[model samples]
Target chain A: MTTDLKAATTMNLTIDVAKCCGSGQCVMAAPDVFDQDDDGVAFLLDQTPPDTERANVDEAIASCPTGAITVVDG
Target chain B: MDAVPVDTDADTRTDTSSGGQATTADDGAAACPHLRKYSLTPPESRPLDEPDYFGELRQECPASTVTLGESGSSWLFTAFEDVKTILADTRFSSSPLTPGFPLEGAPGSDAPVAVTTMIRSDPPVHTRLRRMVAKDFMPKAVEGYRDFVCATIDARIDSLATLPQPIDLIESFALAVPSDVISKILGVPVEDEAMFQELTERMTTLSLTREEQYQVIGEFAAFCDRLISLKESEPADDLLTRLTHEQLLTGELTREQLAGFVIMLVSAGHDTTAGMFGLSVLTLLQHPDQLELLRSGARSWDSAVEELVRIHTVVRMGPRRAATEDIEVGGTLVRKGEGVIASILAANHDESQFGPSRFADFSIPEEKPKHLGFGFGPHQCVGQNLARLELGYGLPRLFERYPDLRLVDDDITRLRFREGRAFFGIRELRVHL
Candidate 1:
């Protein structure tokens, strides 16, 4: 399922590119909110995923090898 | 540049091309003139100052050929995008049975039936076989073994603490952890670990003669057959038993297929993980600042492990694939029937993808780049979650137990590597706690 872009914008998702080891676990765990750059480093497709996408995004954060992705509550 | 002879001594050099397709060039030069004749396996031979010789090639000749002694030559792809594309694209076949496919050491016949495991298959068959056991290797599934893995590491460390100073980390801990974990997963009795480890070691040794390799593989297959029979009557909670009861008995898999599965799992699960553990430790010790960061909690152990795997890639050359049809990779035309070796080592160190200090820098960057350490696409390592868990649990506990841990030999240059092996790792790491 897709996340609501407007709702996601409120979530304050940030990805530290340098910390991203590019394991792609984030993308795998939460494809709607996370995507990888050409080099395989992760990027936020949607900074603030909707409440519906929270669980998977949480999983993405937990699963990230480098802990590069984070979600701050608005 | 002219073709450089890798080995001057005839007796010592390994001829990797037993079933290699004959080259059209009489003088053993690659068809592509710009392609240099180089052996990608043993990175230790390269000059110490220029550790990243392959990086030079990735820049100058992204797709080049390297002659493999008598076995002819194969195309080597060095760029990150090219390597990933080749691995993901189905146009490149993974089957070594195909004629002209690059044979690194010997003919596939010398290897076990499992040499034809799902890793070497393509499309529907690979998808079917891999799907059967894919769930067991998922992050969640591997996470189930976390407690067990951590406990095992602690127990091993506890045992090592009793040992005298200058302990070989590889023998005492690194090798033992993964060996035990894989054994437990396969339901092999702990007492029989030495036997299985021996077989696995022999099977992975690139220096062994074809006959020797075949013998070891035969023993391994027979061992798996016996294990399968045991699981047949009395099933356990382990993977082998699950495969036997759930997949094999249901006619979804054949006896040989079960054997292949067991063999592949046992070998893949331990060797690469063991190599990573030893290499990571060495890499960290060489860079005390990074080690201090890890120990001080400045850098998360999870990130450190990923960075370690990325920087100290064990698998130099991934499985060779033959181009099914003429395909363009990184602007180079790889003609049909040409063999391609995706240099996982080179791609991981590609500066453009990972920034300038990708190879030399030990510090973990805030932006972690995707690496090919576990490979990519459909044939990506199934046991990656398990391997990562082992590293995540093992590395920190190792350093925490002995914060003063350092190499006994200050000269890192003297360190002995498992030369000519498919996986890169220290033969012995004498560490003082």
Candidate 2:
């Protein structure tokens, strides 16, 4: 089942930069688990990424229009 | 003239599916007397069909409270998770100078001073004027201007093969490739692109008047103060010479907010992708098997430009807010200084969010959802990554440089749409290759 939910989950990630709305949509859906800074906000170039970057960190937490990227499943 | 007109008859007196909620106002201060009002009509269909009265107010009462006049009622919302919780809820306030901002022709309180931009400010000044042009429209700074937006969509498809045969397509190639890729990313002057596309087409022509739209918004703020004093004495590597040498020489911007960010980025970068490239080229010439599945490469001009920006939501009466407190959303409530809206053409056609036969189905389904069509929170859409790199290379390079184009009247009410603009487009398509 999708490699048993990526070997029983780990993912991690978190963002919030005051609910970042620089609308990079998490660097256009997970450019290596999100990047954007020169004031476009969003950061974490891999807060915990790999499990083959969990389907682009869950499509950058489902295309973030300010639900400001999250993903716990630790 | 439609920034909420919707009546399309159906209320038969507001029962609104009982479960769909909204009937609040036990003196939550007047005006919800069983909702459904919305006045000021006009968009009576055919710019790539949608007006089935917002799919009958998104199956009635998606978050009700209507009225919108004698300066009163507002709420609206229309499903898709209550228009994504009134556009990612910052307790709703995108200021049309707040104090009950509904903004359908808004201008009172002895109206005068205007240039608000940062899409009518909210967060700490719309988060310091959208973090000074948010890393120049980010998706890796618009994928480093995709080869100057594919050489301005191949020089507007090689000036539509030297014009002649029934050509219009919004004056040769969907308004000349976003007015030559937003006048070369706001450096402007290619000998002032014919007076910046005639003052951004009389500032988005809704039949100008309000004294000729304030004398073409004072000649487009004196042509963005003469292109910010010729980019402060010749500097150029554009985006107004890096915001005229970084935020207008460190006063962190203000030459009337860099001429209201070059008249709000050349009238929202060439009239919303020149009305989404004339309504995504009249929806790929009314879906020729979805333009032969993006001409046989079997789908993906980035999911057919995000399903033609979710069936031409075209800013159809959405983004307006006020609440500032007393929220509630889909189950209604609303209150504290009221006026809400959100709609985005009824939450990108919410048949409970893209089901009930996928809201005006244009078929590109490999799973869809995720469309408020360039709108949602902290003012979503800072040139939506240069409008998806100009509709991902201007709709498959204008159907791969005219595969026998066609459309010189397949009679969709003889084309011309765009009336009193709040972005829904096609005011001249014609075509014929």
Candidate 3:
């Protein structure tokens, strides 16, 4: 039997509503982790992907592009 | 980062023209000698093989502001202090959407000689154009495509790692990455990117004869004409389709003009970032210690990204305007209908603001890394988000994979700047993987 070792990650990429200028830096930076709404604001999907996706998630943070978007743990 | 102040009236100053602001060169002989030690420019400006001429300038002419050729662009500040001031001043505005640099030998109005993607316009126009394109460049748009970018980069890196022939990063990773991304964004087939390279070369060549420039312009226009028409019948999720059918639905811009805009995106979007990719790798490799620090340090990738942009300054100089009334800049006054250019390369390297070690050395201050690679004010680059996508993601993976990667020959004499009016980048970069 497997044990749930981790404290469930409430961590995800957050979009700052006031700073959301609709320039999809987050999506462009990490498409795997972020997506645009109808109005083109960024939202996170499945924050905890497999560890293999870490490289991309790191890229998203690096390229948050607007120098605007950021990652957070709720 | 703040811009260098307009100081032309000093003793070392020479009055050329502007609304009366000019730059001066000061070689501090008695003071700090190392300030000019490690410039980013390669030693001599050669052919396409090398692209780091600015490093040599950084070392040799660290305090000298150069105004090369008859075009008369103000290479401006050498001291870091002045640059910060200029960047802060609202006077040094950007005409980010055009080819009408103060040094641009062509003619246009408050508008530019040519239509471009969002980066070339001054605001209100810059504001609108950027907002329209922002939907496509947002980080959200790139979601789910990380693997696509990763796969593309990995495949190329894989081939390079295995192949015996020396690999040129510009072609394999640099050009390929952006070409792949743009093709996806434009909904154009990846194989068709050859046409883009050809058209980009022809349209953006700076030294072309006026007649040749016109011919290239005509050809570019003709090519876009057909592409827009074809996309008109069969629409896609690409930028061209949105601009043609959807964005135009609002009557904001015309199809003919929109075609020009597409050219700007393809040309500006791909070329600057692609060249920058190669340049970033080259610069980092030049300082292997920095690469190692980047690999091991827990410092943020955004810091590295900002530093990369600040150091390399992908688009070295951007165009600007006189606006309706005459404006002042690095000294000397002129009437209306004049132009100016801001040297990003010079400003980024200025030694006054950043401690000599703080900028190039990755192990320094982990706080706010000042950089203008995204530019300032109304006309900051609209595609900055996408450009960072390549750098921020691609660099770390590159380091992780080819930890020992470096330039084969360490001679500054051999490097040459790419030939074009648009962006300063290498034509080719051969490396030992």
Scored by CA lDDT, what does every candidate get?
0.72, 0.70, 0.56
Q: What's the ranking of the predictions by lDDT, best on top? A: 1, 2, 3
Model 3 Cα lDDT, one tens digit per residue, B1-433: 1111111111121323222122331323333232221122322332222124344445554333333333344333333333343433334444423232343332221222354445445545655666677667655555546767777777767777876657787888888888878777787666778998888866665555445655666676677777788788989867888877876656887665676677777888788888788777777777776666666785666676777677656565433433233443333232234334444555566555454432235343475456666754334566776777777788888878887777876653465456434566766778877
Q: Counting only residues 3 or more apart in sequence or on different chains, how many pairs clash (N, Cα, C under 3 Å) in candidate 1? A: 15
Per-residue lDDT tens digits of candidate 2, residues B1-433?
3223232221222211111122364544554444655632434443355555556666754666766433345667667887887888877887666667764333211123243667777787788888888888888888888998898788878778887888788867777788788888877877787787777666655444345656677777788888899888998887888888888888887787778678878877877888888877776787688789778868777877877787676766567787877777655677666677777766776765564323235677656457888887888888887887888887777787788888877766555666655566767778787
User: What is the per-residue lDDT of model 3 for residues A1-74, given as tens digits with 9 covering 90 to 100?
Assistant: 66454423334455564344465545555667677676565567756555555667766565443434455643
Better of 1 and 3 by TM-score: 1
Model 2 share of native interface contacts: 0.74
What DockQ values do the models have?
0.07, 0.27, 0.21
Q: Which candidate tops lDDT?
A: 1
Reference-based lDDT, residue A35, model 2: 84
Q: Better model by TM-score, 1 or 2?
A: 1
In candidate 2 the C-alpha lDDT for residue B303 amounts to 76
Residue B48 lDDT (model 2)? 55
| CAPRI rating of model 1 | incorrect
Clashing pairs for model 2 are: none
TM-score of each prediction: 0.81, 0.33, 0.68
